[model samples]
Target: METILDKIIAKKREDIRNMTELTINDLDLSREKRSFIEKLRHTSEMAIISEFKRASPSKGIINANLNPAEQGALYESYGASAISVLTDVYFKGTFEDLKTVREAVNLPILCKDFMVERKQISHAKAAGADLILLIAAVHGKDALKELHEYAAELGLEVLVEIHDDEELEKAVSIGAELIGINNRNLKTFEVNLGTTEKLGPLVRQSGAFLISESGMKTREDVVRAAKAGANGILVGETFMSADNLKQTFRDFKVPLTVPQR
Candidate 1:
């Protein structure tokens, strides 16, 4: 029986291969030469990178209009640490999202996509991205290492995502200081906060800026994750589903204040 991670990884390898075939004349990253992503100097200050995502493999019709720049502007306005933009075209997203967001927000913009090859590294630079998310399940150990290194050399930050304890090892091995724990199971599309609960300790061991991703729907979940040692939360559905994203971030800042006992 294959896990969700297994299937997504296989799918990414094929998706990336096809995307590379596109010959582009518009993008230009000619003067880019910095390893911003891998540079340990720039630490993830403030909160988790708020993701301006449109849809996912599991959930459909998340947000069609998804104005990436508008969302980024909102997240930045509310004092978010970074903005994550989904760039997988098949997933109803595009690199244009990151480009637009990067232009609007002052914070770092994470290129959240099904990354498998180096083509995306160049895409990040050309599109004005500050960070990139590399899913460990979709990349072999060697490939993950190489990709992280490559992204680092370009002055970009890398957020290595892991679904389980086993994958955490791979993330650390590749020197992934910024880590994202996804709760949604890739194969069955099931979600359980326990995934983050279980992996929290492992990530803490490595001292990475840990973020809990997927299945995050409520402010209570955010507070719970913080208790479990999570530094930030990468959310999409809850925030994206809103009509006013800036208000959503403002709402998130309260973190469900409890009544006095």
Candidate 2:
């Protein structure tokens, strides 16, 4: 019995395979893809790429009408390093979500979707996406390598997401500059913050920028991740699901008291 994740991923793979009929090489490239990569490279601050995720498998709809654009604008105003928009429609997001963030903020907007082929690349590029995520677990090494090269050619920065060593090695081998270490096992949706603490260093050693994803609910988690050499943190559920989203995000930055040193 294939789970919802399995079904969605399979359908996506088929869509990508079907995309061959359109002749990917002949498809025109959008200018926004190149511009988006420029903005991300310029935001040198070590800050959160705050995500506006509506729902997740572990928790039901957190905010059905949260208005991603408005929320993203607010996040940018509050000093978010960047914005993350989930473009997986079945999981509570779409290209519109990416556009919403794009229109509302000057900060970079990363399209958090299961990108399989180049067609979606043009879609995301046209929709105002500044960056695109390419999950290593979903694609074979060859496919990821091809997509990564294509994305670079399109002028989009690729966030190569890896869950473990196998994928991490592949990500490094492909010369990915941005590495996202996802703590959640998409196969079972089980999260272990330790994954970030565990693999982040090895990824950094390979020369890619590092980020910690999932299982982060508190400032301690942020500090722990930062100590692990994470260049940035991608936070969504804890902030968006809180009763007071603004305050929850703010609390992560409250200064810790120290005995007179």
Candidate 3:
């Protein structure tokens, strides 16, 4: 039987096959851009990268009917530092979804997907993505380095994602400026926030900006991760599962707020 990752990769290959008309060279490289790294660096409040995730391999459909543009606007209005748009077809998201969010908000948008090929990076930039996620587990160090350089060439920032010490070393060796620690194990799909705690110091020692990804639900979770050295947090399920997304965002950032007179 095929694993969840196997299935997703298969589907991605099929999607690429269907887009034969749009070669890498056909991609529009001149979309006016916002700086994803700059937003993270300049953050004064809780540096939250709120995500527009409709489904997942583990949990299936999540807020399938929520409008991407409207939700993007709401997250921006509530002070999200950046936006993450899942563009995987298996996740029930499309490039159109990402583009819609980009048109809807001025904040930097990360094209969150299982990106493996240069064509995908080109498509991301063409769709108004300000950044792309490069998972260390998926491509390993060599390929990850190559993809990171290719994305930078297209004027797209890369969030080099790692899960453990080995991956963290690879990211550091590559001189990755933005590194993300994913708490969820891709092989088992099990989430453990302690993953960030374990890898946080290594990332800090590498002198890269750190983003803690997955398994963050409450303000306390954010605090714990920050205390461990995460400079930013990429939160998805928490905000997506909230009945009131705006209020949930406010609550998550409460500690970062100053008292009103």
Candidate 4:
């Protein structure tokens, strides 16, 4: 059965074919690169990576009127470790959103998209993104290795996202220093915080920076993730829908009880 991920990847392939070539010179390499992992490592609290997202396949039209620049600034002022901007068409996002956020905030920006090719990474870097997301379920091991290496060569951090133990093994095998355990399964769109409970220890024991992604809402959710061994948490809908952005962000900044190995 074809899942939403399949549709997104299919659309990405089509978009990739139409994209123009972008070289290293086309990007602003002189801009100081902020380390996303370093921020997580040094933080005593569960690092919050706030997202500037407009929509998603499961929950469409989250906040269509959201201004990326303003939201990015808010996240920064509220002590977000980093800012993530959705750059996928299906999500009603564009690379322009990322550029706008980059111009507004000094925080490390993650270009949240269904990245398949190196060209996409080039586009991300050109748009002022310091990091890119590579879903483990999207590519074969060899293909993922190539993309990871290519992103490193371009001076961008790769957040390798995984759903299960199989994907986690693949991420580990590739020497991925930043591993994101997404509670929401991309194929089924089902969310379970237990996914983090099951995978977090393994990721932490591997000595990688473990991040619990998706379905994080209240302070309890943040605590659960932290206790499960997450150095950071990637939050989107909760922040987007919050009436008081600053308070909500601050509330989620719970301390990590688990020691980092």
Best by lDDT: 4
Clash pairs (backbone) in predicted model 2 = none
TM-score per model over all chains: 0.82, 0.85, 0.92, 0.98
| Model 3 per-residue lDDT tens digits across residues 1-261 | 766677777777777875534455777777777886776566555578999998998998877888999999999999898999999887788999999999999999999999878888888888889999998877777888899998888888999999988888899888899999999887778999999888887788778888889998887888878777787889988888898877788766733221111
Model 1 over residues 1-261: C-alpha lDDT tens digits?
977557666776776776543223444435443343332234433155687878877777788985777777777777676778888754688888777887786777788887777787777767887788888877789999998997776767788999987789999988888888988776687889988888876787787867788776666677677666676778778878867767666655533122111
Output the TM-score of candidate 2. 0.85
Scanning candidate 3 in windows of ten residues, the lowest lDDT window is 252-261
For every model shown, the clashing-pair count is 11, 0, 0, 0
* Candidate with better TM-score, 1 vs 4: 4
Span of 10 residues, lowest total lDDT, candidate 2: 252-261
Candidates sorted by TM-score, best first: 4, 3, 2, 1
Kindly indicate the candidate among 3 and 4 with the higher TM-score.
Answer: 4
* lDDT of each candidate versus the true structure: 0.72, 0.77, 0.84, 0.92
Ranking by lDDT: 4, 3, 2, 1
- Candidate 2, residues 1-261: lDDT per residue as tens digits? 766668778867775675433343554554433343343345443457799899876677867878887889889877777788988755688878888788888887788888877788767776777688999988899999999997777667888999999999999989998899998888888989899889977987887778789888887887777767677778888878677767766755532221110
- The ten-residue window of minimal lDDT in model 4 covers 22-31
Per-residue CA lDDT of model 4 for 128-247, tens digit only, reads 999999999999999999999989988999999999899999999999999999999898899999999999999988889999999998899999999999999999999999999888
